[model samples]
Target: MFILADDMGFGDFGVFNGGQSSTPQLDDLSGISRLYSQHTSASPVCAPARAALLTGRYPQRTGVIDTLEARGTDRLALDEFTIADAFSRAGAVTGLVGKWHCGAIGEPYHPLKRGFDEFIGFRGGWQDYWDWTLERNRTPVQADGRYLTDVLGDEAVGFIRRHKHERFFLHVSFNAPHFPYQAPEELIGQHRRTGRTERVAVIYAMIAVMDRAIGRIRQAISDAGLDDDTLIVVTSDNGPELGGDGEESADRWNVGLRGAKQHVFEGGIRLPLVLSQPGVVAAGEDDTFIHLTDWYPSLLTHAGVTPVGSKVLDGRDISGSFTGGTVDDVPRCWQWSRYHPMPTSNAAIRDGRWKLVHPAAAGTLGLTDRDEWIDHDIKRHPENYAQPIDEESPGWPAVGTEPMLFDLAADPEEAHDLAAVHPDVRARLATALHAWYEDVELDRARLVST
Candidate 1:
């Protein structure tokens, strides 16, 4: 099985959602695959999302509720079992190429120490596309004059060539379409005519490069005749940071899904996910609402691996959705909190078509227990707050009030808040969210105190 994580934007792919940017490769490939119309990472940031993907558990469950950054040396614990470790245990030669934001500059957090036998990537959240600071098992590579996306593709193809004979799990986590979005002259000139500049230009160029690299990876898989043997998975970490570092307007992107990147709205959490395994799983769209935690059990079931959780917490084995099956019965939930006033982008939950969002209610005595996690953590483990949390930092929005709800199927843009219209859904979902968090806190408190 192989995973290709594309840091794509909302309007990036043409197969699932119609778009102006021509992505023929993704379009053609998606048609022969199953698409997740409503998929979300445990958290909207890179490190947290990656943590959830690797552990097959919620990021919060493993203290990865926020993006992993170099500050305070925060990282996934060395003893933690990662998806790559699971694959390795299953006898699959695993490797990770591209961004490794969970943690860097530490042996414990490095992919090599985290169950990946061959690691080719970097530890930073982002780097320049043309001039990158990458690594092969912590050995820095002079990307010299090559574009990052292209370099990653080269490494991926080489890895496949080196390990194609066995069951291998290659995680090609592309950092393109993220930031410092520099591109080749031709692509830039094309977008220049369209008046794309600054962040937009960078985003377009990065996506274009990423798309081309995807073609290379796809071609390599087909050439090795492993297309049928491999389980190809693709998705983005989070939504686009519209105005850059998330301080600007969403402009024409995010497709009116409401909010971007850090919020719990559709645009922030909902993502495009596709999984195809040919004879094992069929093609087409599965309008299922599942979270990153689902991949753990789902992949485990498919590969004959063991469970990551003791009592089947959070996510379910969503692989059934690949064959016209569904995860519609599972109520999708989201909860977020910020340290300050930041456009009311926090706390949300979706039960069926109804989505309830609590926007920055941290100041009120009526603050939900969900928001209390931060307050308690700050007080209980003040040392944990040692990391710098400026706007540019990874784990952000240090503080936030208000709650909103929407029927996403009817209001995908989250234009109208129907919290008043459907108080029962809000109350019940909120209660469930509160109960779940309370349980998590209890377990964490027990572990920490002991």
Candidate 2:
């Protein structure tokens, strides 16, 4: 069972740093599950991150670098091999019970056609919690006045109940705490009692409700007697969406990390991960760098199935790393250039403790100026929600022309830049990052041509 939270930050959980609201269920889960302290989402945005999570490859390679449009022709290519397909081929029941933002316009890119036997969720990037359209295996269904998060949890629990006797790969994705900040008034009042602002209180309330829903799902797994057989992994698609007015509260939830979502900073891409499988994997904390893309191969390996496709995977199986083992400390590159074929903005590469960041202006870098690609919530509530921009934000600095280098080991907040101090490390990492960009662009070009 894989549980994914939408737009949840590292510090949102008590296991990470204890935000204004308590997450007792997740805290207890961390006590029994392996806490990955150095895990990162594959992308800074939604659709791309999800694409990488499902395919075990970079979103750029899968042609899902941007969020899909409702009327546009952009979609995840049908040729990409998915983890659900791998498990289903291995004779296991597969289902996805949450946000399926990978693709939605056509049947070819639908979740049902992408290897999932069951899919019950919304297809767009954001949906209303109180009222929204839902589809069950590509068919529209009534929501029945239930909260979206709870609906997903109920569906996941039902799937587990029905398939408890067989091997199942259930992806219980919760599109919670993302936008509109809607939750029960009781939950909202609970956070408000903590002396938090209205915006922060609403966000925390949503998170708290989501945590409880996850706890219910966990209990369902335990009750089904499939805890030992299920390799459960919980993580988020991206970091938290910090509003413009709540910097202090953001620090409380983000643990003083620099930058927020939509940037390549640690706070944007870094995530909190918990992996548990009872007797198979031990419970402990690991700082090994794990990407969302790695879940594909890791889950397949844990399911005792060999990958049957000839797709070139950018992710490595890190199942051993959960059991007091180590993985290769190689350079990992992350890029974010929406609506552009070439990656030229907010690109970064991490090699050991040194990280090189290439930040560019909004209009420069040959990237498309997607000024209208604002979040729905932000558009509805501009004062309450804000994009992670440096001009309006205090801690977030403007991206300079010169690439910056930071020793994450010493400066996790990215307060200091060592680009000039350590030229050798900067040159090596920059060269590698540029080379990686070249490779990604070349691969994309070849795929486009063929």
Candidate 3:
């Protein structure tokens, strides 16, 4: 069981939030689970992070460099081998319940065609929480008055029950606290009564609802007698979405980590990871630097299934590391921008305790008018936007030419810059980051060209 939350920060967990948000269920689960304190999402944004998570490769290599589906930037290349493909090849029933932002166009990019035998979710980055139009294996299902989060949770429980007798790999993805921040009035009132601003209240309420749903899913798993057999992994796709500056902003407690979603800072990519399996994986905290991509090979190896492709994978099988085994200390890199990727913009590389970042170019930080239109088109008329369309380049001016360096071991919040103090380290990491950009961009170019 792989459970994901959208736009949930480390502070959103009740165990870390100092009780600002309600996540009692997750707090309880944390007691018996192995908490990875230094885990990170592969990307700062949703589509690319998901791409890396599913394919065990960098997002650029998978042709999912950005999140605009109408412009086709979010589509995962068909040639990629997904974790689902690996699990399904091992004869497990694979199901995806919730947001499927990796692709949102034609049937070719659908989850049903991407190794998932069962898919019940939306295929877009954002959706209307109240008037959601979901699909169960390509068949549209209109909202039936239930909250969207509850609906997805119910579907996950049903999947578990139906496949209790068989080997299954279920991905329960919850789009909580992402957008369309709507929650039951009761939940909102509880947070609002605590003096939280309206936006923060709504966001917390949404997360509270999701927390309840997650608890229910866990109960269902236990009821089905899969507690000992199932390996449950809980994590988020990326950091919380901080709204525009104001008291009404969506910002809440984020453990004092710098930056928010769409940034390359620790707060953007750093996330909470919990793995639980009774008597198999011990309960404790592991501060190893684990990336989202690691789950692909790790989980497959844990299930005693060989990876299903000859394609090279960027992730290492760290299943052994869960139980006092050594983890490879390797550098992880991330880059993102609107529309086409800008290698020099919003890019970061972490090699051991040192991190080098090229802050986003100011002009490239937002979506263009056409990008906004494309997003709207995909949400409203997905059929009409099934194919990619040419987009005019923003041609934004570049900034932040000088890279910023931080020693995360001493400054996990990335508050201090060590670039001038450690020029040699900065130069070395910068060269490596540029080389990585060139390599991944070459693969992306080949994929798009063909």
Task: Assess every candidate by TM-score.
Answer: 0.85, 0.90, 0.98
Q: Write the per-residue lDDT of candidate 2 for residues 318-425, one digit (tens) a residue.
A: 988878799876678888754553344688898889998877545432322243454343323333422232222112234434689999999999999999999999
Give candidate 2's whole-model lDDT: 0.77
Per-residue lDDT over 1-450 for candidate 3, one digit per residue giving the tens place of the 0 to 100 score: 999999999999989988888899999999999999899999999999999999899999999988887777889999998999999999999999999998887678899888899999999898888888899888999988998999999999999999999999999989997887799899888888454678998898999989899999999999999899999999999998886555568877799889999998988999989899998888898888899889899999999999877888888888986675778778999998877778788999999999999998887768877678778767767778747777565775544457999999999889999999999999999999999999999999999799
User: Which ranking of candidates, highest lDDT first?
Assistant: 3, 2, 1
Q: Model 3, 261: alpha-carbon shift in Å?
A: 0.4
What candidate 3 gets wrong by more than 4 Å, as runs, is 193-195, 398-400
Q: Give the whole-model CA lDDT for all candidates, comma-separated.
A: 0.67, 0.77, 0.89
Alpha-carbon runs more than 4 Å astray in model 2: 71-74, 193-195, 246-252, 363-400
Poorest stretch of ten by lDDT in candidate 3: 392-401
Q: In candidate 2, where is summed lDDT lowest over 10 consecutive residues?
A: 386-395
Candidate 1 or 2, higher lDDT?
Answer: 2
lDDT of 1 by residue, 272-310 (tens): 777887887878777777888788778878878775424
